[model samples]
Target: MATFAQDDDGVVVIIGSGAGGGTLANALAKQKIRSVVLEAGKRHSLEDIENDEWAMFKKISWLDKRQAAGGWHLTENNPTLPAWIVKGVGGSTVHWAGIALRFRDFEFRMQSINGDIAGANLLDWPVTLEEMAPWYEKAEKHMGVTGPSTGMAYHPWHNSFKVLATGAKRVGYKEILSGPMAINTEPYDERAACQQLGFCMQGCKMGAKWSTLYTDIPRAEASGYCEVRPQSMVLRIEHDAKGRANAVVYADASGTIQRQKARVVCVAGNSIESPRLLLNSASAMFPDGLANSSGQVGRNYMTHTTAGIFAVMPKPVNMHRGTTCAGVISDESYNDPSRGFVGGYRLEILALGLPFLSAFLDPTPKGWGKQFTSRMEKYNHMSGVWLCGEDLPLENNRITLHDSEKDQYGLPIPVVTKSDHPMDAAMRKHGVAATARCYEAAGATDIIELPPYPASHNMGTNRMSAKARDGVVNKWGQSHDIPNLFVSDGSQFTTSGGQNPTLTIVALALRQAEQIGRLLNERAI
Candidate 1:
C-alpha cells in the first residue's frame, strides 16, 4: 500500500508479481528492503475467483498476442496463445496446480551427467542441489508445503490419484504420493485448508493452494516495504551512460506511460515476457539486448516435454472432485538414457473438468466425432495424468521479438518458437506408451492421448551459468552485464528439470533475495 516517489532510485523494481517476483518482494521486505512490484494485469482477490473454467480463463489468463512457430503442437493448435499463464499480481501462481517438486541432483548437473547430449544445449547450473537445499527448505516452510517435517500431512489420495497410484503399482512403479504440494492438507499458513474443490488452475477459492496474490504480495505489503502496482505493463528498461539499468518505462493502468527509477531491476516476468522485456530493452551499448552479451537473453527456451493421457476407467473415478494435481509418480524421474532419453519425467494426476477437456482433449479436425463424444460422456469415469518431462534447451528453441507485430503498448510481441528434440519425441512416445500400459493394467476401457497443450511450464530463456559468456545471469541470478539487474523467475533456470518449475522458482528467488540483501548491505552491487 505504500507508494514511493517515481524518482525513488533506491527501490528495487520487480516486474511481474508472480511466484518469483512476489516471493522475492516478501523475502526482501523481511529484511526491510523496499521494492516496487509491477504486474501487467489487474489484480484479483479470493472473492473474485470463480470455479468455472472458461469464466476463470477469461478472468485471469494472459491472453496476449503471443505467436508460436516451429513444430510443437501448440504452434498448430494455440499459435496466438502459446502460453497459459496468469498476468495479474500473482502471475502464473494464480493459475498453477500446486504440484511442487524439487529438482533432482542430476537435473542440476545435466551437462556434467549427460556428458554432451547431441543437439541439446545442456549446461550445469552454477548452483548445485547441495547449495540449494537450504533455500528449498526455507521456501517449503514459508509456503507451507504439505509433506513430512513440515507439520502438515500429505494430501489424501483423491479418486484420480488413487487410480494413478494403483495403475503405477501394477506397472512396477513405486514412487507415488499426493503431495509435497503447496496446497494444505491441514490449515497451517493462516489460510483455510482446501475444501476438496478441483478448480485449482482457476485460482484457489479457499486460498489453500499457495499463491502469491494472497500470500507473498500481501505479506510484502504488510511489511510496508513493498508497493504492488497492478496493470503496469513494462515496455522497456532504461540505463544511464555507464549502461547500468536505472529505470523502467511502463504503461500505467490509465494507459499513460510512466517511468519508475530504480537502483536495481529484477525481471521476474516469467520466461516469455522476462526475455521479451530484456530484448525490448536493447540499447546502443548492449544492442543485442540488455544483459544479453552472450546472445542468450531470449535463447534456449524450454517447456517441459508434456502431454495429457486420459483413460476411461470402468468405474466412476470422479477425478474432478479434488485437487487438480493430486499426486505424482516420480519413478520415471531419473536420468536414464537406456529409456531412450537423457532425462526423465513425472506422471502427476491431472483432472480437468468437462469444459477444459473438450477444448484440449484433441485439437485435430477429426477430434469431435465418436472418440471425443465417448470420452466426454465418460467424464465421471475418467482418470488422467499430465506427463511432464525434461525439455532440452536448444539455442533455436527461443522467444524472439517479432519483426512486425507489436502489442497495444507498441512493443514487439514475443514469438515463442519451439520444437521437439529427437529426445523429446522419443521421451514423449515412451512416456505415453508407459502411461497407456499403466492405465490398461488398471482396466482402462479406452485411452486418449492428448498433445501438449499451451505450455504452463515455461523456462530457460534468460538462464544462469557459472561463466558470463555462457548465459545472461550468474549463480545469483544477477545479470552478468548489469550487476544490479536480475532474473528471479523460472527464466533463470539452467535446465528444465523433470518436474514442476514453481517450487524451484520460489527457491531461487529466496536465495537470490538473500544475496541481493547481502550485496545491498555490502555495497557490492
Candidate 2:
C-alpha cells in the first residue's frame, strides 16, 4: 500500500515475490527499510486460487516461450516446456508442496567430501551448514514449520502415507516418517489447520500452507515499508558509470515501459529467468552480462535428478486424498559412493491427480494406447513416490539465450539445455530399484517407473563461491562484480542437495537480509 516515487534511489528493489524475495522484503521491512517488489505475474488472492490442477496451473504457471535441448528426454517430449515455475505474485511458492528440509553437512561440501567427479562442476559452498543452522532455525520458526523446532504436531498420516510407511518398513528402511512441512497442523500464525483437501499443488485454498502470497508479502505490506507491484516484468538492470546497479526497467500491465531507480537490486526471479535477465542486460562495459565477470551467470544449471514410481495395489489406496507429498523416507539420503553413486536421494510419497497422471505417467507419443489406459483405470488403486536426488552440475547444462527467437517484448527467449551425468543415471536407477522393492514389499501387483517430469526444482545458475573466479556471487549472495547487486533465490545455490529447496532458499534470504541491513546502516552500498 505504501508507494515510492519512480525516481527514488533509496528504496531496495527486489525482482520477484517468492520465498526468497518475499521473505527478504518482510525482513528488511522489519528493519525499517523501504523496498519495492516487481512481480512479473498477476496478483491472485486465496479467493482466486482453485483446487483444480490444470486450471490453477494455467492460471499461474510461467508458460512463456522457452526451448529445451541436450540429451534429456524432456527436450523431445516437452521441448517448449522445460521447467514448471510459477509466474504469479508469490512465484513458485504458491504451487510448492511444503516439504521443508535442510541440507546435510556433507552436501554443503560436495567437492571436498566426494572429491573430483568426472564431468561434474562440483564446488563447496562459500557458507557451510554449521554457519546456516541458526538461519535455518529462524526460517523454520518464521514459516511455522510443523516439526520439533516449532513444537507443532505433524499432520496425521493419510492412508497413502500408511501404505508408504508399511512398504518402507518391510523393505528394511528405518527413517520413515512425515518429514518437516510448512503446512499448518494446528492453527498457528493466524492460519487455519490444513483441511487435507488433497490439492496442495493446486494452491492451498484453506490458508494452511505457507506461501508468500498470504504470509511474507502481506506482512511486509502491513508494515508500510514494502510496495508490491504485480504484473511488472523486468527487462534489464541499469548500472551507473561506476558499475554499480542503479535502476531497473520493466514493462507494466499496460505494456508500457517504466523505470524505477534503486540503491540496491536483488534478483530473485528463480534460476532460469534470473540468469536470463542478467544475460539480457549486457552493455558496452559488460559484454557478457551484468555481474558476470567469471562468465558463470547461466552455467552449471541443476534440476534434481528425479523420477516418479507408481504402483498398483490389489485394494483401493485412494492416494490422492491427502497432501501431494505426504511423507518421506530419508534413510538413503546420505553420501555413500559404495552404492555406485557419489550422492543419494529421498523417496517422498507423491500422488498426482488423474489428469496429471495421464499426461506425465508416460509422456511418449505412442504411450496413449491400451497400456496407458489400463493404468488410468486403476487410479484409485495406485500409490506413488517421487525420487528426489542430487544431480551433479555440469558446465554445459545451462540457460542460454536463443540466437533468433524473441518473446513478445523483443527479448531473446531462454533455451535450457541439460544432459544427464553418469552419476545421475546411477542414482536414479538405484532409487527406482529401491522404490519398486518397497512397493513390492507392500504387495503391489504391478509397478511402473515414470520418466522425469518438467523441472519443479530449478537451481544453480548464478551460484556462490569463496573465490570470485569460480562463481558469480559471494558468501552473502552479493554479486562478486557488482557490490549493490544480489541474487536472493535458489539460483545462488553452490550445489543442489537431496531436499526440497524452499527451506534453504528462505534461510539464505533471511541471512542476506541481515547482511544488507548492516551494509545499509553503515552506508556501505
Candidate 3:
C-alpha cells in the first residue's frame, strides 16, 4: 500500500514484479532501500486462482504479440506465442511448477567443461557455485522449499512419480527422489500445506506453492519502502546526458503515458520481453539500443532443450492425483560428454489433464483422430515424464524487433528465432529414449513422444560476462555500458543449466541486492 512520488529519483525503479524483481525489492527493502515495481499485468489474488487449467491459462498467460521463427517445435503448435510466460503482478512465479534446483559446479563452468563446441556460445558464469551456495541456501529457506535447508522433508511420492519410479528403478536409474520443490511439505512460512490438488500449472489456490504474488511483493509493501504498480507497461528507458539510465516511459493502467524518475533501473521482464524493452529504448548515444555496446542484449537466447514421453499403462495409473512436477531422475545430470552430448539432462515426472494433453498430443494438421481420442480416453491409465537438458546458447538464435509489426502500445513486436544445436538434438534424443525405457520397463502398453513445448525456462538473452565485450551485464547484473541499469532476471544467465531456473533466479537477485545496497550507501550510483 505504500506509494512513492512519480518524480522520486531516489527510489529504484524495477520493471516486472516477478521472482527476480519481487525478490530484489523485498531484499532491498530489508535494508531500507525504497523501490517502485512497475508490473505490466493485473494484481491477482488467491481468490482469483482456480483449478481449471485452460480457464486459468486464459486469465494469466501472457498472450501479447510475439513471433516465433525457425525449427522450434512450438512454431507449428503455438506460432504466435513461443513462450508460456505469465503476466500478473508476480510474473511467471504465479504459474511455476514449484521445482527448485541449484546449478551444479560443472554447470556454472559450461565453457570449461565443454570446450570449443561448434555453434555454441558457451561461457563460464562469472559467479561460481561456491559463491552461490549460501545465496541458494538463503533462497531455499526463504521460499520454504522441501529441503534440509528449510528443515522440511521432501514431498511424498505422488502416483505419477510412483509409476515412473517403478520403471526407472528397474532400468538402473540411481539418482531418483521426490526432489526439492518450492511447495511447502508442511506449513512453514505462514502458507498452507498443499492439499494434493492436481492442477499445479494453474495457480495454486492453497498458497502452498511459493509465489511472489503473495510473499515478496506483500512483504516489501508492508515494509513501507516499496510500491507495486500493476498494469504499468514500460516502453523505453531514458538515459541522462552522461549515458546513465535515469528514467523510464510507461503506459499507466488507464493507457496514459508517464515518466518515472529513478536512481537505478532494473529490468526483470523475463527473457523475451526484457530484451525487447531494452532494444526499444534506443537513443542517440545508444543507437543500437540501450546497453547494447557488445550487440549482446538480445543475442545468445536459450530455452532449455525439452521434450516429453507419455506412457499408457495396462491398468489405471491415475497420474493426475498429486503435484504435477515433484519427481526427478537425475542420473544423467552430470558432465558426461560420453552420452553423445556435452551437457546433461534430467527426467522429471509430470501429469497433465486431458485437455492439455489432447492439444499437445500432436499439434499437426491431422492431429485429432480416433486414435488420438482413444489414447486420451484412458487418461487415468497414462503417466508422463518431461525431459529437460542444458540448451547450449547460440548467438544466431535470438530475440529481434520486427521492423513493421507493432502492438497496442505501438512498440515493435518481438520475434524469437531459434534453431536447435547438434548438441541439443543429441541430448533430446538420448533423454527421450532413456525416459521411454523407464515406462517400457514398467509394463507400458504404448508410448508416445511429444515435441518441445513453448519456452518456459528462457535464459541467456542479456547474459552476464567477465568483460564488457562479451555480454550486456557484469557479475552483479549491472549493465556494462550503463552503470545504473541492471537486468534482474533469468535473462542475465550466462549459460542455461539442466535444472529449473526459478530458484537460481531468486538466489541471484538476493545476491545482487546486497551489492546494490552497498553501492547505494557509498553513493556510487
lDDT of every model, 2 decimals = 0.91, 0.93, 0.91
Which 10-residue window in model 3 sums to the lowest lDDT? 70-79
Runs off by more than 4 Å, candidate 2: none
Residues 1-525 of candidate 3: C-alpha lDDT, one tens digit per residue: 689888999989999999999999999999999999999999999999988878998999999989998887666667898998998999989988899999999999999877878888889889999999999999999998887899888889988898899999999999998879999888878998887898776688998999999999999999999999999999999999999988989999999998999999999999999999999999899998988999998998999989978999999988888988989999999989988788888899888888888878777776788988888897899999988799999999999999999999999999999989998999999998998899999999999888877788899999999989999999999999998999999999999999999999999999999999999989898
Clashing pairs in 1: 18-90
TM-score attained by model 2: 0.99
Model 1: ten consecutive residues of lowest lDDT? 142-151
Per-residue CA lDDT of model 1 for 217-261, tens digit only, reads 998998889999999999999999998899999999999999999
Question: What C-alpha lDDT does candidate 3 achieve relative to the native structure?
Answer: 0.91
lDDT of 2 by residue, 1-525 (tens): 799999999999999999999999999999999999999999999999887889998999999999999999999999999999999989989988899999999999999998999899999999999999999999999898989879999878887888878999998999987868999998999999888899998589998999999999999999999999999999999999999999999999999999999999999999999999999999998999999999899999999989999999989999889877869999999999998887779999989998899998899887888988998999999999999999898999999999999998889999999999999999999999999999999999999999998998999999999999999999999999999999999999999999999999999999999999999999999
